[model samples]
Target: MQKKSALGIMVLAILFVSVNLRPAISSIGPLLDTIRADLSLSSSEVSLLTSVPVFCMGLFAPLAVVFNKKLGLKNSIAILVAAIGLFTLLRGILPTYPVLLISAFFIGLSIAIISPLLSAMIKRNFPTRTASLIGVYSFGMGLGATLAAGLTGVFYSVAGWPIALASWGLLAIAAILLWLRVKEPVAEVSELPLEGAASVSPWKNRRAWYMLLFFGFQSALFFSVITWLAPIAIEKGMSILVAGAVLTVMSTVQIACNLSIPLLLERWPSRHLWIMVSLGFGAAGVLLLMFADMIFIWPAAICIGITLGGLFPLALLMPLDENKTADDVNSWSSMIQSGGYIISALTPFTIGLFYDRFQNHMISLSLFLGFIAILTVFAFLLNKKPESAGE
Candidate 1:
């Protein structure tokens, strides 16, 4: 009975923290134009709103190990969540470009570190249930993005961009509260290594590089769609509200798949096959967006949603699948995410730059096709050269 109660709380605590991770980035999409026009920023410059955080998420991911060794998983997450909340709140309170940029960096860093810590947390607590818990974690993030994408427009209409942007921080407060309820097992805490816990960097392995590239391209596709999908909808003669609704559809569809794909993977566990399926959906999504526009907006969103839903959990599983020990999962995941995020971080800003240069959403959308193709190649490569056990 005690065990059941604690597990329930742990699940809720995971949901809360996972939910807070993406809003700082996703919320900006619905309000991008308003922000750009109000602040006199260019498309590329505004793209930094998403890019900077992603950049930090990649560059600072190794800090996860450093944080775990010093503060312990429990305290590290608490501090990071608090920082996420504080920075998110500051965005609304300060409401300046410089402040927004600065706040974005810290928010991204905090999120970056929390990721591996949470993975470590899940590994320690639910060794046998990692896949299901990862689904929960992914679903929570999808839920956060869906809410932000769907409702930030409403929030902006009601209280303006400052409040809409800043209000997301409140999620952190709730996360912190529930997170307190999740007590780490004493044994797990006592076994935590302090000095020289790091393993050979994932960078040293070739298959690890393949995993990084695969993660990077898939993530690039995901973040690009998140940042630009709504604006492209609006460009096709939809209202901001309708555009927001379109993004809502994309994210909502992703949530359903985020939950379902793991179940599907249970039956068919081929990473290459699943990823190829996802990239096919992504290609169709981009083509539809470019050629069909709002006429097939729902279809495009759904296709992209399928692609995102399938790819993320698969990416999360890669290191976990390759590694046996929790430490290996932690080390490989940090390297994969660190390099993957850095590479993926460039897509949004690059798309924005292309839009500015070509003044055409077609060109920006074409880039998606390019990313999908590149991703498909790496997907094939990763499968062709499977990482050896304990590699």
Candidate 2:
């Protein structure tokens, strides 16, 4: 009974942390206009503020593994979650644009630490159910993104942007408290080598590099849309409510697809095919938003969201599938996430810069989506290669 209770607490803690991770990033889109207007931010500035935390996601992700080794997963997650709570809360009260921007960097860094640790924790705690647990983690992430898109917009309309921003920090607090309830199982500690735990280096593996590129590019694609999709809808003559609804629909579809894909992956020998299929769907989504009339927007939104749901988790799962030991998984997780998030951090700003230069959304959207499509194809080939599989 005690074990079951502890297990339940850990699960809830994981879910709560997962749910808060993306809202810090996702909430920016709906509130972008207000934040920009109030702060007199330029287009580039808006993009930068939004993208900075994401960049920190890459910059700080590698540090988590180091901390994990020293603190163990239990203590590391608690400290990181507290940091996330602190920074997220600070983001709400910051007095200037620079302060907010700096806050984003710290917020991003905090979440980055939490991200890889969760995956490593699951591998340590639930070895037999890694895939399914990861699926649940993915679903929680999507749900956070969905809530940011849907609820933040509503909150922004009702109470304004600061309130919307401040409200999300509460999730961090909730996660911190929940994390406090977890006690690390002895089996989890047994998995780590006590002697010279720091000797294992995941950077030596070529597969880690591949996973890094795959995860980063896929992340770039996910954030590009999350940051801009609603604005795109509004640009295409849809009302704000409609645009927000479209994003909501997309999030809902993503949640459904994320939950379903792991089961399918279990049946298939290679998930590489599904990765390409997701990119194809994402390409179609961006294209539809770029060129098609309003009638096609919902379907396109759904495609993008659902496709991301599968692709994002698939990226996280790659290192897990490939690594036999938790340390290897941690190293691969840090490398891939650090690389992936660095790429992701630049995407929105890059897209925003192009839009500022040309005042053309289609060209920017097309090129971004097209680039992701090509990368996805490359990743598919690479992931499908016999070498992509673990020993």
Candidate 3:
């Protein structure tokens, strides 16, 4: 009973930390115009508020393993979470472009370092329940994005942009307090091979490379839709209000899927089937958006949202499922994420290039379809053998 209670507390703490991951970045979107007007910033300059952090997520993800090796799991998480909270609070307190830029870098650094380590922590503590716990983790992140995007504008009306951005820090403070109540994870040495898991380099692992490529394309698909779905709707002749509704549908379904997919994996555990289904939804949605009339928009949104929600928790589960020890999961996840996010961050820019040359939303959507097809091939290769499949 005591163990159960401790697990409950730990899960809540994980949820809190998962939520803090996004508000420092997502909050900027809702108030972008207001922020730009106040600061008199150009579009390219203002765009860095988001892109800089994404680049940092890719560039700094490997630091997660470094922190784990040097500071140990609990210390690393605590320090990183503190960095997230402190930099976020500084954004509100300082409230200038240069300070905001500086704060964004630190906030991004904190998130990058903590993400993979947290995955290993979940695997270590809830070895049996890793799937459901991951569901909770991704659910918390999706909830964070929703809350930040939905409420930040309202908060700005009540306070100024500074206070609005800073209000998110209160959530971080609550996260820190709750996180203190949970105990750190212990390494499971007996389960690992004779060779220490820590010494294994993911750079040489073919499976880890597969995981990296899979993660990159899936993230690219999700972010491309997030960045382009509404614009696509508008380009296809929907009014601005109607276009926003399509994006809302996608987001709503995504959050629901993020909460549910890992739980489904807990019961079904057929990774290949879920992976194919999720990718199929993504491909179908893109096709519908590209070729079908606006009447098909609702179905496309629902399908894409389902794909967004399902793929992430599954991608997260892959490393945990493959590795025996927390250290191995950390190495594998960090390696996967490090290269994965760089692939993801470049996607929007590449798509913009396609748009520049072709000048049609259809051209971009067609490119999305081609990527999805390639992703499907990788999916089959990754899960073709029964051994590789999380059966």
Candidate 4:
């Protein structure tokens, strides 16, 4: 009974923390124009707000392992979550662009630290239920993103961007409080392999490269859409409220997809096939947005959301499926996420630059489609066998 209670607390803590992960960044998407206008930021500068945090996610993920080793997982996560809340609050209160950018970077760094640690926590505590818990984690993230995307405009209308952006910090505060109440189980120590018996690096493996590409492009797609979708809708003549609704719709669909994909993966024999199919939806969605009339934005958003929902969770699960030991999982996850996010961090800024250069979204949408294509090819090329350190 005591063990089950502890497990329950851990699960709740994970879910709450996951819920706080995306809102600080995702909220910016729906309110991009308002923020840009209020601060007199150029498109490129605003794009940096989105891109910097994601870049930090990649830049700072490797440090998570070191922090976990030094501070212990729970304490490290607590400090990071508190930092996230602090920065998020500051992001709203701060008037200067440089201050906002700095806050955004710290928020990203906090998320980066918390992200991998959650995976390691799940792997360590709920080994038997890692996939399911990951699905729940993804679902929480999607849900948070959906709420932020959907409601930021409403909050903006009511109280302006400062309150709208800062409101998300409250959720982080709640998560931190809940996290503080949970006692972490003492982690079992595993002996590091001797120097001669060191595991093969994931970087040397072709399969790991393919997995990284798959993860990277999917992340690019998701971030690009989140950052640009509402603006694209507004450019197509939709009202701010309507654009927010479209984003909300997409995120809502993502929540459903994130929750269900794990179940499908369990039953499906070919993960690659599912990945390809999901990528196809993403490509089709981009194409739809590229060519379709504004009236069809609803369907386009749904397609994109479905793609994000399915692909994001699957991308996360792939690393766990591919690696054997917890150490290998950590190493591969760090490598894949670090490299993938660095690549992904470019998407929004590049797409924004393309839009700025061409004064049209065609080139940007085309670039997004190209990323989908790359991800599809990589998905097809992924190895059928599970990854082993010996390999």
Work out the TM-score per prediction: 0.92, 0.88, 0.77, 0.92
> Model 4 clash pairs?
none
| Candidate 4 residue runs with Cα over 4 Å from true position | 188-198, 383-391
Question: What is the lDDT of every predicted structure here?
Answer: 0.85, 0.76, 0.76, 0.82
Q: Quick one: best lDDT, which candidate? A: 1
Please identify model 3 stretches exceeding 4 Å from their true place.
1-4, 29-47, 65-75, 90-97, 153-165, 183-202, 205-207, 228-248, 263-270, 291-298, 319-331, 349-367, 386-391
| Model 3 clashing residue pairs (backbone) | none
lDDT of 1: 0.85
* lDDT at 51, model 3: 59
Question: TM-score of the candidate numbered 1?
Answer: 0.92
What shift in Å separates residue 270 of candidate 4 from its native position after superposition? 1.2
Cα lDDT tens digits, model 4, 1-391, are: 9878888888888889999999989998998887888888777788888899999999987677677778987888899998888888886688578977898899999898788778767767887997678867877888889999999999888988888888888897888888997885735222221111217788888787888888889999999999999999998998778899999999998888887776787789567767877877888888889999998889989888889888887887776787666667666777787899998998998887877777777787888789888887787677456455455
Query: In what order do the candidates fall by lDDT, top score first?
Result: 1, 4, 2, 3
RMSD of 1: 2.5
10 residues in a row with least lDDT, candidate 3: 187-196
RMSD of 2: 3.3
Output the lDDT of residue 107, model 4.
92
